[model samples]
Each structure stands twice: as structure tokens, then as C-alpha cells.
Target: MPEVVQNVSKEGVKYIILGCGRTGYNVAEELAKETEDLIIVDKDEKRVEDLRDQKYNALVRDFSNPGFMDGLPVPEVAFILANDREANLAALKTIKSRYPATYVIARAIDAVSVDLLQQEGADVVLYPQEVVARTAIYHIRKLHSSRLALRLYDLLASWEGTLCIVTHLNPDPDSISSAMALSLIARHASHNKLNCRIVYEGDIGHQENRAFINLLDIKMERLTPQMLEECGYIALVDSSGPGVNNNLPKSTRVNIIIDHHKNNTQPPSAVADFIDIRPGVGATASIMTQYLMELDIPVSKTVATALLYGIRADTRDFKRNVTPQDLNYAAFLLPLTDADLLDKITSPSVSLETIEIIGNAIRNRKINSGYLFSNVGYIRNRDALPQAADMLIHLEGVNTALVYGITDQNIIISARNKDIRLHLGNVMAEAFGSIGEAGGHATMAAAMIPLSYFSMAKDKEGLLTLIIDPILKRFSEIVGLDGEGEE
Candidate 1:
């Protein structure tokens, strides 16, 4: 391992350990490196003086003061382990104030203190006791539940690590961002190749979302029959079932599924990989955040910002449907996120093309039987479909709004509704089946179709209308709003 390690051999790593008690000593022992990187500090002079006298790097002083941290040669990376919460936090604060550039990972006593440490500039926080307890309980439950037991077995099942097809349900910021982030993870493994493809049948619908898609360069390539046949490993991200938002190609035998939606039912295979589906959490991105923490992977600033944005956009910033996991992930990502990048992603300037789409939505809009409908065209940014749907829903007499558009090679639709009981995913699956695909939550929906659906979409309005109305009629029938014999 030492021979293979291609670390920068420029300078020796300097460690500033705050306590020499059990945990701190354990840390030092773990770091008993051949690189001669050793620095241990303890308050008891008599106990540590002998080591200092023998030429071992040791400091015998009560480093209780935040100022005491300045005297030590803090490494570019420092691991601080003080037993007491207040003392640990103080040492962390002092380390950051002095060595502002250090990558600090601190030992924490509880979950809440981790947040404080992060706020004080600690890059990572670990509560050993709490983690051990959670691990024990999770595994215990897994052992008892045969279903969970098999899935755990599957994650490591050396299917030479096949592709994990993850779906983003209701495909929000967090769901989509998490799917992309997980793709990066699956790609890093030696034998496994993870190809992340985004599939959305409805509109993103929000201006900020439209901006995020443009800035992040997120593209959804529709799945094909050949691609499905070739894939062996499968993972679901946000959405879960066939009858729901996904018509998962029957070949996609799901191995793992990480989600936070309400449970409909568990997936079927005995050898399934993992179902880290936590219903209590607000955002799936939060669940992915916890997984990253468990793997001890360092999230880049962009990843941090993206996860943070996902959580904020989904949970409305810890205000709604936020579980412990949601809060934990938000707390985890907040300090790591780049404030400027997040701001830029959240408030990107609208383009003239976007404005034109909005104009067309209004100019050709219609309202009937509580449904506001419109046919749009030639638009590039897929973000506007849902936004147009949402805007149309705001019309005085509208109960449902379905906005349709035709790009050169695709038929795009964003559906919005004030009806609280309808399942938009089911509605889309039934409506768009003949032409294309649609998937999203009840209040919001989106779909994508092949070029064949839009024969002369380039022709001003004639061709676009022919393609959109039939789909809308299908949707109306599915929702039981279509009159007489419509289909």
C-alpha cells in the first residue's frame, strides 16, 4: 500500500490532536504512518513529557484556549479529536481562525454538535457511538426481514457491476441532481459502468429549474430497447413502480433503489441489491447525501452546491416534510456548498426564447370545463413546459392546465392541476402511451415523445395542434374529465 501511494512527498503531514484519551489515541494509532507524520497534544504534562523528552512529537499543555491552536504547525489537512463538545468546538474554531485553508475533520459527540463543528469550518464530522448504534439497528432489521436481507446481498453481488437505471419521480431538483451525483459514484468503480440517463414525462415548470437545467448542462436522452437489453445492474432513484411514473423496460431488473417517497410496496426480486427508501425524508438528494457520508467520500463544491440546492428546493429549506435525514443532509451540505454558485443556479437570467414560449402559451391558450390548455412550438429549453403548466393553472377559471410543445425531434408536455386526488403519473402513462412517455407527481406532470409524433412540427400551428389535442383528450379520459366517447 505504501509503495503504491502516489502522494505529494513535498512536506510531512502535521497532525494537531487535541486530546490523548481513548478516541484521540485511537486516531493517532490509526495514523501510525511510515511517513513520520506524528503530532499528539495532551493536557497532562507528566504523562506526555517522557514522549516529548524521547524526541517523539508531543505537546503537554492545556489547549483549552482557542488561541493555543495558533502556535502549532497545522497541516493542510487536520484531524481534531477533543473529547468534550465545547472544547472540541473551541479547538476547531481556533484551528480554522489560524489555518483557514486546512481541511478539517473533527470527532463529534452527537448529531447536533456536528452542525456546530461544520459551522466552525470543519469539513467532516463523525459521531462514532451514534453511527455504531444505527448500523447495529439497521443490520438487525435487515437480518430479520428476508426481503431487506437479499437486497443487501445484491449491492455487492458481482454482476461485474452493471448499469443502475435510476428514475427521478416527479423529477424535481433534488431527485434529478441526486441521480446525476449517483451516476458519478457508479462510474468510479473499476468493473462497473454507470450510465445515468434522465427520463421525465412532464415539465420542470419552474423558472429557477429552467435556469438550473441550462447552467448545469443536464440532458435527458430517452431510453431505447437495445440499451435496456444490454443493462444488467439496475437502481431506482426517486420513482418506484411500473404503474407509477416509470414504465421501466421489463429487462431492467432493479438491484438497488434509493428513494424518499411514500411506500406503495417493496420491489420483488429476492436477490435485489438495495432499497434505501426512507419515506420520512423530504428529498431523495438528502438520502444520497447520507450515503456519501457513509462512504467517507469528499464532495466537490459543485456537488455540494447541487445537493444543497436539491434539498432547499425540495424541502423548502427544512420547513416542510423534512425528516431527520433531510435535516442531517442539509446540515451536512450547507457548509460545503459554495454560496455564489448556489445563488447563480437559483436565479439565472431568463432568455428571450423562454419569454417567447411563455408568449405563445398565452396567445394560443384555451379554457374549457375547468381545464386550461395550450399548444406551443419550436422551444429549446425543456424547463418551460412545467412553468407554462403552472402559469396556466393560475388562470381565474382553470382547475387543470396541460401545456404542449413540439421541438424538432420531440413532443414535450407539462401538466398541472388543482385537483388534489388525481395521480398524474398514472394519468400520463395512460394518455401518452400511444405517442410517447410521461412521468411526474399529481400536481405536476411532464412527457417526451419521439419525432414521429411531431410530423410537421416546424409548420407554424397546423401540425402542432394535430399532435397535441389527441394526447390531451387521452389525458382527459384518464382523469375522467373527457365527455361522452372521446378517445
Candidate 2:
């Protein structure tokens, strides 16, 4: 019989920890700093006593037995860190079955145990070794990024005169924020010697994008041929290569390129003095955030809000194709950001036409396998098509969504995919690259096909059918779907 330790006040205990081993003890010690409501349970009296000595609430009981957890207060979080795999699995199953609502975090000793724990209803199964290794790697990368930032600072310091930071046409938040961050870095490093300007070719039509620019007070101008002539060096921000989407001529000189999107085609790296293209990163804003942190620059509240919004928008609040760096930068910026401003930037009022367009998309949607296809007929707001596509992709069974509309003399297509196997941008490029201009990130892509490529139709339905049918057929074939079936 194990000796039962005196019960500590259970009034505020929110985290119930099973097992007082090294892992559990360490976790408890860290968590204890945050809250007083923590209880540690173990089968061994010695371990229980050790925890008690460390001033933690400890109990000696058979944690594997379901009855042992019956009378304990329902905790918000439960950690199962038993030394034996069988004991850990049994405790996890018992707690999950009894307290189905509790968030169970279990430690796994091996790969097999990790899978078994997850199967046994462990909400989060963590391998301590793997986590530690990842932490080490992340820190090492952080150091490398610091060095790279200093090198970039030195490089920028060498340049004299205006440094044009160009974004893709009709710049999104990611492009705008990235350009702003780069300009900030360049200005700081050059001590205002190097003049940096954000320039793009198209209109900022998206409501949220407009809010972001106005709220942040971002200064950007329309790009022209003459602008390039006066620029000492050109730096492409949130854009992979020149002439792909921007007004810059392909033959024009590009000194630097910083982008997070994967190049649809390989870029000529030799042409640019510096190129940092990280496709694994969720947003270009994250890449810029790292530079800001590495340089230890004081990030303004407005700038922090812009970067934060840019990251969240691009990553769909970290639900899309996000990486560890994205999460880290987001966390770094969260505290610095103005919450009220972020709310305003994110909660922009949508026009009634945008709402109607979304309704038309849902009504006209065709689902084949897990793919969704919709055409919003003719739309005045081209940006609304992508917004509609993003919304449609969240439907219960849909894994891929493609939304398109005829605007002016072009057919605009916006594609989004949650399925990891399909790269939507590559799909769009392959499907429409030959017909018109098309390219985007891995998960989201857009294409612009000129009306001249298709035969003119008399009515709206006829035009939609003529353009949308070929696109559906081509896209379906590319994604390995055969014979379109309506939902």
C-alpha cells in the first residue's frame, strides 16, 4: 500500500498530471509557475514524495486503474507521462473515456507508442526527443537568420540611391506588408541614405487590402517604365521573377528578389544580386519578420499589425500551408501588434455584390470527387472570385475549389486546395499557362485568360459555358478526376 500525501487545495487545479517522472515533473514545474491548480499523480511512493518535496501536489495511486481518477476535479488539461507504455496508454484511455472534454496531452517514448497513444484518444502525443531536436534546430536556424540579416544590411549599405521594392500587381496584404518590412529594413540599414519605395502596377481593389494600406499608412506608388529608369537598384518583394506578374520588363535588371512562393518555373538566380525565395514559408511577411527580429529593429505597432495580418491572411490563420517559421514570427509579432487595429484590418465591410457573387458560386457549384468547380458568370469585382473560391473550399467534403468569372475581356480563375497532394498553383499554371497569364502559391493560384483566346458568345450563359467547360475538363484531367459529376 502506497502512502497517500495530504491533498492540496483543489479550488484552482486546472491541470491534472499523471506520473511524477522526469518528464512529468519538469512539465509540472513549468506549469506550476503559471497556475496553482496542478496535481501530480504516480503509482510509486518515492516519485510522489519527490514531487511533494518540490512543493507540488502529489498523490500515490495506481493511475492505470479507471477508478483512481473518478473523484478528481475535472481538469482543463491532463498530462499522461507514465514510464511504461502500457500504463500510459491505460491512463490516457481512462481519463479520455471519463473526462471526454479534457484536453489530454501524453508523452510517447517511441514511434510505436506515439501512434498507439493517439489511437487511445491522446489529443496531443508528444515525443520528447523529437521535440528537443526540433527546438535545437529552430534555435540554430534563428542564429543563421541573424547572420544573414547582418549580411543583407551590409549589402544594402553598399548601395546608394533609391531601392525600388516592387510587389505583384494588385498587391495582397502579404505583398504590401512584405514590401513595407523590406523598405523599413533598407531604410534602417542605410540610415536613410538608400531611399526605398513600394511600387506595384495594378489597383488595390480588395476591401481588406485597401483597409490594410490605409490603416497602416503604407506609401506605395504605381510603377512605370520611367520609375525603373531613375531607380539605382530594383528589389522584388513578394514576387519571384520579373515580367511574371509585374510591370517590369523581363529584360530589365533585378538586383534582389525576396518571395515566399515557389517559382512556377525556375528563376534565373544569376541575374539578381540577392534572392531569398522560401516556398516552405507560409507568407512573405514571416520572412520579413525574421529580418526585423534579426536586425533587432524596433517594430512600430502599425507595422507589427500589418505583418501579423499579412501572415494570418496568407496562412488562413495558420490553417493553410504553414511552417514552423510562420508560427514563430506570428508569435513574435502578436504582442507588438495593435489588437484594435488588427480587428479593423481583418473585419472590412464587404460590398453587396460580393455577397451575391458568393451566392451564385454556391448555387452553380459542381462537385466531382472532392473537387468543387463554380463559375460566377460575369463579375465586376475580380477580387471577389478568389474570396468565393476560398469560402467554397471549406465545404464539408470539398478538398479542392476552383472559382472563375468573366470580367471585362478576361476570364479570371481562382483556385484553392486543402489536399496536400495537389498544388493548386501548379495546376492553374499547367491548365492555363499556354492560354493566358497564370501563377500563384502552392495552395492558392490565379489565372487570367484573355477573352480573345475563346470564341465570342451571344449570351451570358453561353459565354460561361464556353469558357468554364474547357477549364473544368482540363483541370479535372490534370487532377486525375474522370467524368464530371454534379453535387
Which prediction has the highest TM-score against the true structure? 2
Candidate 1 lDDT by residue in tens digits, 333-398: 889988977788877777677778888888888776777778876676767776677677898887
Q: Output the number of the lDDT-best candidate.
A: 2
Give lDDT: candidate 2, residue 428. Answer: 81
Evaluate residue 274 in candidate 1 and report its C-alpha lDDT on the 0 to 100 scale. Answer: 63
Model 2 vs truth, CA RMSD: 7.0
Candidate 1 shows a clash count of 11
In the range 143-188, model 2's lDDT, one tens digit per residue, is 8878878887888988889999898888888988988888888888
- Compared with the true structure, all predictions reach lDDT values of 0.68, 0.84
- How many pairs of residues collide in each model? 11, 1
